[model samples]
Target: MLHVNGEAFEVRDAAVGESLLFVLRERLGLMGTKGACEQGECGSCTVLIDEQLVCSCLVLAAGAQRQRITTIEGIATETPTDVQRALVDAGAVQCGFCTPGLVVAAHSLLERSPRPSESEIREELSGNVCRCTGYGRIIDAVQRVAVSRASAREVGL
Candidate 1:
């Protein structure tokens, strides 16, 4: 059995050794999770399993069974997590290939550290590689999100 995107599924008879990335993009059509490198080195396949970021390409689909997994689609459909909106407003998106994974990583970081410092943001996102934006803009985006979220919390907004 599997529960994905707020839905229940019966996968008891399904294959036992498929990567979560394959099941997501091939079976479920959730292609927001990129398949870059196909290895765990690049964080492009990042997804949240029980709110912790993991490389879907390296994770077994069976291991994700019953766990709450969040992908780029899930985040985009919501109110655009503060990190996402900041990324856009900060002009951090270029090429756009790495945005989804970066967004997922940022979401995990914010969930755990809410007010992460610049160095923390850099360290957290080090695994994700971006060919455009030169990373300066990406760091700025994360910092912007952290600041904006802090302000919102202070005013109870």
Candidate 2:
């Protein structure tokens, strides 16, 4: 059984060595987690395990038992979060293969540093690679979100 995306699922036939990535995509049909590289080098399968970011591909399904997992679907919800909107508005997503993991990583960064500078955002998002754009827009997106949050706090939103 797995608790994923705020729901409980019985992954009854999971193999002992099966990864949480496999369980999320193949067994549970949550395709948002891309299996790029499958070696944990790429952050495409990033998910929050007990609020800490980890590569789902590196986590064995059996090891994930009773742990809370939050995927991209879990983050965006019905309405996109500030970071998601900023990324789209800044045209950061090109191939979108790395967006989910990037989003998860960015969310984690913001949780730690609400007003991260450009260098901070870049350093934090370095793990999630994109083959499409040069990451200028991605950096801009995180910056925009950071600025927006700062503004919102001033306005008490």
Candidate 3:
């Protein structure tokens, strides 16, 4: 059994060597987690295992039992998150293959730091690689979300 997106899914058919990325995309039908390089080098298959950002491609599905797994699909409700909106507004999404992972990474960084420095954002998101938009816009998106969130907090909203 694997706990994903606040739900429990029985993964009885997962092989010992099967990766969490495969189980998430194939068995669970959570296509939000993209699979680029099957290796851990690419963060396209990134997810949160117990609130920690991880490359799902490097994780074992069966090994994730009892752990909380949050995918891009679980990050927001019906509407897009502030980070997601900022990413779009900043024109950071192109090809979109790397967006999910970048979103997850940025979300994790903001959750921990709330208002991170430019270098901090770059360091945290270093794992994700976006070939389409370079990285300037992606950094801008994260910074934008951080500022927006801070403003919301100040207004008690």
Per TM-score, the best of the predicted structures is 3
Tell me the tens digit of each residue's lDDT in model 2 across 1-157.
7899779998877779999999899999999888889888889999999999899999999989899999999998888998889989999988899999999999999999999988888888887888887999999999888898999899999
Model 1, position 135: C-alpha lDDT score: 90
lDDT winner, 1 or 2: 2
Q: Each candidate's root-mean-square deviation in Å?
A: 1.8, 1.0, 0.9
lDDT of 1 at 21: 86
> Whole-model lDDT, candidate 2?
0.90
Could you tally the backbone clashes for each prediction? 0, 0, 0
Residue range 83-131, candidate 3, lDDT tens digits: 8899999999989999999889999999999999999998999899889
Error of 2 at 115 (Å): 0.6
Clash pairs for candidate 2: none
lDDT of 1 by residue, 41-82 (tens): 888899888877889999889888779878888777757777
Deviation in Å, model 2, residue 125 alpha carbon: 0.8
Candidate 2 displacement at residue 65 in angstroms:
0.6
Candidate 1 stretches with Cα past 4 Å from truth are 10-15
